[model samples]
Target: MACLIKGVYIAEIDRQENRREDKQIAPTWWEAFHFKCIKVLEDDVDSSIFGAVFEYMGHQIESPKYVIAIRGTMIKSRTAIRDVYMDAKIALNELSHSSRCELALEAVEGIIGSTHHTNVWLAGHSLGASIALQTGRDMAKRGYYLETYLFNPPFLRLPLEKIKCRKIKDGIRFMQSFVKAGVSLVRKKTEEYDPFILLNSWIP
Candidate 1:
């Protein structure tokens, strides 16, 4: 289930990229999920990071939930490689947070400040996952709790002793539990299912 959700966010990122390239105005897959794009966040100062804010309204809900989905490395050129390296540096805390990632988080904070919705979720893939985790940690420090879903996150070499914040440590543990439970559920459900059918149905 975690993998499925991650794939959905990745597909949304691809759709957003295609829309940008073609300059088309079309409904995205999020519409089917009852999510509408509220804001598209981009940083011209640092083009490596980009994200979108979505408002979700499910059938049983009277209020909306907000989601911030960040895009991962494009890897189309040398610049993309540089961006990935920067993400690694940020992960290791060798450098301060990436400007692009910081900008993206600030944008989300701005939206959250103005909105009444209390449920906020964050998601990203690869390098974007690193950014999301870092930003979520910062937000946690600021007393704004956010649930985060990261797919194939980069491994940071920081030791547990180096992390001073107990809240951040707890948050990390929570994310790990959430991911483990999701993987367990997915595996249990697919134990007797055909691999080809699962792949065809899940992969888009």
Candidate 2:
């Protein structure tokens, strides 16, 4: 099966200064992720484009395992979530804790509900990657056969490498001036930007 690329936008509310507004990110915003997968049971990296990033980076999805890919919007993790947080501060909005979970859960449902039961591996660039890990855990708890690969997810330290990508509630954060600057500099339509497309380098 060839990898599938579907674009979607999710709504979010910032939780800092009291807000009830809806923000919309372009479907193309997700058209900007890139990733390569390492086969879990094999010694080789598949080199298949599993999701939107591959397309963003100018590649095509061509393999059985890469068949189900869904691109979601605006839920940036440390990489993109910071912008969500700061933007909320600017707009004076808030997300009740439950609402946050709803956002993630709904996304998980949307992604998984559209796929087959074959060996599942969840991978996302940033916040999307974090969600992928969360989905993996949920699927395991529900007895679904799945393996998850996260790319540049929020840095989480673990005694073991395999447990590094586990939960979203436990996601760790690091202050980054460079990320903030990039978000600020690229938000302007006049600035000529390609949605946040950072490399996959960071696992602990």
Estimated TM-score for each candidate: 0.58, 0.32
What would the per-residue lDDT of candidate 1 be over residues 1-204, giving only the tens digit for each residue?
Answer: 133234344544455465563453333456666777677665455443256777776764643487787666665542466566766686567523566677767866887787742577777777667777777766655556666788887775437577999999888879888998997788777865533333332211
lDDT of 2 by residue, 1-204 (tens): 112223321212122222343333323333344433211111012211123322223354432233223222344332244435523432342222223223444444554575653423445444445445454554544545454555555543434445555563244323344666667776654333232221112121
Model 2 worst lDDT window (10 residues): 39-48
* lDDT over C-alpha atoms for residue 5 of model 1: 39
Top lDDT prediction, candidate number: 1
Q: Tell me the deviation in Å of residue 82 in model 2.
A: 7.5
* Candidate 2 regions with alpha-carbon error over 4 angstroms: 1-83, 86-104, 107-115, 119-121, 156-204
Judging by TM-score against the true structure, name the best candidate: 1
Candidate 2 displacement at residue 201 in angstroms: 25
TM-score of 1: 0.58
